[model samples]
Target: MNQTIHKSQEKNMILERTVSADSPRQDELVPSRYALKVGEIDVMVISDGVLPLPTKMLGHNADSATRAAWFSDMFLPADAFDWALNAVVVRSGGKTILIDAGLGSDPDLHLPRAGQLIKRLESAGIDLASVTDVVLTHMHMDHVGGLLVDGVKDRLRPDLQIHVAAAEVKFWEAPDFTRTDMPQGFPDALRAAATRFTREYRNNLRQFDNEHEVAPGVVVCRTGGHTPGHSVVRLSSGGEALTFAGDAVFTVGFDHPDWHNGFEHDPEEAARVRVRLLRQLAETGEMLVATHMPFPSIGRVGIDGDTFRWVPAFWDY
Candidate 1:
């Protein structure tokens, strides 16, 4: 296994650093804890750890210098231009549902360790046994690997209903998901993830043909841009509403909403949806939680002239 690189210094020179682990799990693996309330619904933003990813991976059209100028604070920790992985947890009508299960113990992949969802959920007094549902925004390595433990040990949400974008799943699991233009391990990892969506998981699994109320007060709507069948999960109750825009907007990624991520299946379509979704979120003024934004990634987008600005909310917990 590769060593986790950190910072270090010696007598009069700089020193390279790394974190070695006897076991896969590590403390503070996941940071960025927060929560919110939209009307009567309770929302929690759980950390899936942070990775200093390459800006090139974002697939933006801008040059490295321009991109760096745009996201000045994106280099908060290690002078890294990054997009964070933040998972959303929703509790309503006595039900607990996780929006996305982040990456597990996969180091070969650029993704980081984010299998702490179950532990963090348990810390919040949420019993894994009673987690009624798990709605995935998409089945990327970092999003769905948390469904099961490493080596496929146990079902994280045994009795919960698993929601997926049917077309997206088909594409990833298809024999040619990665042959043409997709990332290297996208298809292979997804195929392994099929086991997590077991017989019971599939029995409870569903796909949104159009807009449908998959759960009480929780509706799954088709919004394909990031992927072929990507969908947005929206919730409304007691006159207040919140939309979990999976990867539609990655922080200021929407600033250039027309900008697309490199990993996206359709850059043009993804760019189109990013602009359209940002416009909708800005115009509607709906509070949103996304799978990847900065830490504590739940906020509303505000319209500032043509571009929309991210308006972060204060999370009590």
Candidate 2:
């Protein structure tokens, strides 16, 4: 009986290996996307993979000892960190809206793990042609690079409308990076990506001033902190609401809301925006999602003494 069981186990292992080898991409070990509902609106959060960045990028203004202590407390590596890249898709009023695209290919940057948005969307059965609109949080490469990926334009509908803030377009016209503290080679890459995206999709842009309602109960509002035109998408229906905060909030913002992130063009104003948004979400008890938060990124904010707390929603599986 023991010999028979061992042989069966070996046979099963061999079969599994064969299947994985035949369809490597389809056999992901972990889930890459999550789906949920906000009242009547259907929402899905897809993971575009992760970006490994230096630890200092978390808070350039913070002292090394303080940053080290925070990292120790969180049990994270002291030298580097992996930032989650998340994009959202919403369906409302018969309109399909893509909140933000993920990082596309950039070999020069040496970030190979990212740029999975296109494949993941396809795996989720979301055809590019089916996307009726795209609402950008900002013109950052990670947010707009997916659209600029080769052949993505050909797949998308010719009449598809891309919603962005007027300030974002104007800022990128002659972008000012005096305040940003990005790593070397980032600013140039960002500038090139933004310029190419704007030039290629000039006619499809539907620039708005402050706020615009793309569909029923779906509103995109400019917050202007991370970038001049940075915005967040708010979905409301059946008395429930959820906000898709672009770069307004990061994972570390909960404990250190005043810390200056390296990517913020105006760090001071960005801090103010983070604090205000967290306070509002805490007071109203509404669900919040952000681009850099962990996958699914669905949760509520609670006031924890002087700082805020992230209450991750329990999986409804």
Candidate 3:
């Protein structure tokens, strides 16, 4: 009996050591999720992955010197900067709404570092089936890519109702959408993805024209510029409000809203929209959640004389 007891204790010790060895480290890059209470609603900010853009592709009108100076001011190298792909999950009105599904399941399409949205969602304890609504800010691949699962079109959360700008849907779905005015393969890719979205979510897709309430406290505001149908989502309750500024204002653009970017479908119009939204948010003192901002992507805009500044949300913990 003494020998048997000794063996059992030894086995238990081994099990404990094994469990300790497998424990996640503090430095590990686990699922990045943040939760905030927007009045009576619960909002979750999650990351799909970070995307690295070549320096030449940034700040369309800004000269190299200006770009370098801006990066230096922030104590960050211009060449090392990346775009954080953020998606939001909102639990309100007895519904689970996901805004901007991330880079999908394949890492090869845009950046190999991305395509972690589904995994991150799972890690965040969010069931894919529980996502009752998907409000896309635009049809950009990065935003809509996660609609797919394992490279199969519309396989990820297919049952969820998708809401998009009516103009955006029509633009991408037009038979003549193969025009070469845009990037070489952009029109084709957009059309293909839009086609799949149309087919798969035909019964579940919802399109809106102007400012319309999508949920009890969520409204889709038309803030065109990045894309014709690109819009921002506004959530409000009891006078407290937050706006998900989907790609309207980028990192540097916060200070230089006039310095248009190369990726904008209409740079001039995009700049106008961005400046207007920035000023409005700053004046209203409301929180702004940007998709391409830093990891948490939750921040606020402050008007600085004629320009604006970004104030990233402080860690509550």
Candidate 4:
């Protein structure tokens, strides 16, 4: 009986090895794309790739024990967390609007696993030139880097209109806006990129100060916290709605709305905005699309006493 069992196990191991040899490497496999119907509009959630960040950077203000507890509870590794790089493409009103450009084409500066957005879009049959407008959520490198290709800014396509928050432009443009929160050389890099973008687009770049509609079914609202001009986009058609919460919360952020991320310019203000937004989302039952959450980062928030909980949206075909 023992010999028979051992032979069966050996056979199973051989079968597994054969299957593994036939399968493609994980990195070579095409990333999954997700889609949802918002009334008549089609929303595509494409992935740039996943970024591995230190777990300590998240919930920086929380106590060590609390952070550890949360991480352990979520079954996350203690040292690092895999953060998703997601961007939205909204097709409506005869316009193809990309909410945030993914990490730029370079693979060295960003994670090599990331920066596959352009290829992914092409695979989806989305013509690079068909993207009419790029609505920036903020000036973060991870969010706006895709606008540049081979050192040229706003080169994603020709005759494209780029929209950004006026306040965000002001914050990044100020000569003395240097701060410790930004990565080293970030301010200079931003300045250089901004210069190129302005020169390239010129009259085509539009900056707005307050809440305003950018398209027939899209509007931008200032939700300052992560940055002075960090904003969210509201996509609504018919009665369905989804708010693109830009860095408003990372994974497990909904569970601790008061916890501040290390990258936040104003930690206090960020916490306040998060608490307010989480509560509103929980009560209203509106859908949220977060850039840093897991891939296909669409979900809903639910009230959990003073805090909130993240409920990932069900995958629908």
lDDT of each: 0.67, 0.92, 0.79, 0.78
Report how far off residue 131 is in candidate 2 (Å): 0.2
The alpha-carbon RMSD values of the candidates against the true structure, listed in the order shown, are 9.3, 2.7, 5.3, 5.5
Per-residue lDDT of candidate 4, residues 97-164 (tens digit): 98888777543444677676777777677887888888888877677777666644443566777888
lDDT of 3 by residue, 1-317 (tens): 99999999999999989867764345434548899988987899988778777554457577889888888888977675677889999988998999998867543445677767887787678888788888999887778878755553344466667889888887676644321233345556656766776776678778899777778999887777888899999999877889998888788887788876656777888889998999999999899998888878788888888799888888775
lDDT by residue for model 2 over 174-285, one digit each (tens)?
A: 9998988888999999999999999999999999999999999999999999999999999999999999999999888999999999899999999999999999999999
Best by TM-score: 2
Worst 10-residue stretch by lDDT in candidate 2? 21-30
Clashes of each: 1, 0, 0, 0
Task: Give the per-residue Cα lDDT of candidate 3 at 282.
Answer: 91
Local error of candidate 3 at residue 48 (angstroms) = 0.9
Query: In model 2, how large is the Cα lDDT of residue 147?
Result: 95
lDDT of 1: 0.67
Looking at candidate 1, the ten consecutive residues that score lowest on lDDT are: 15-24
Using lDDT as the measure, name the better of candidate 2 and candidate 3.
2
Better of 3 and 4 by lDDT: 3
Pull out the clashing pairs in model 1.
59-262
Over 4 Å off in model 3, which ranges?
1-31, 107-110, 151-159, 174-191
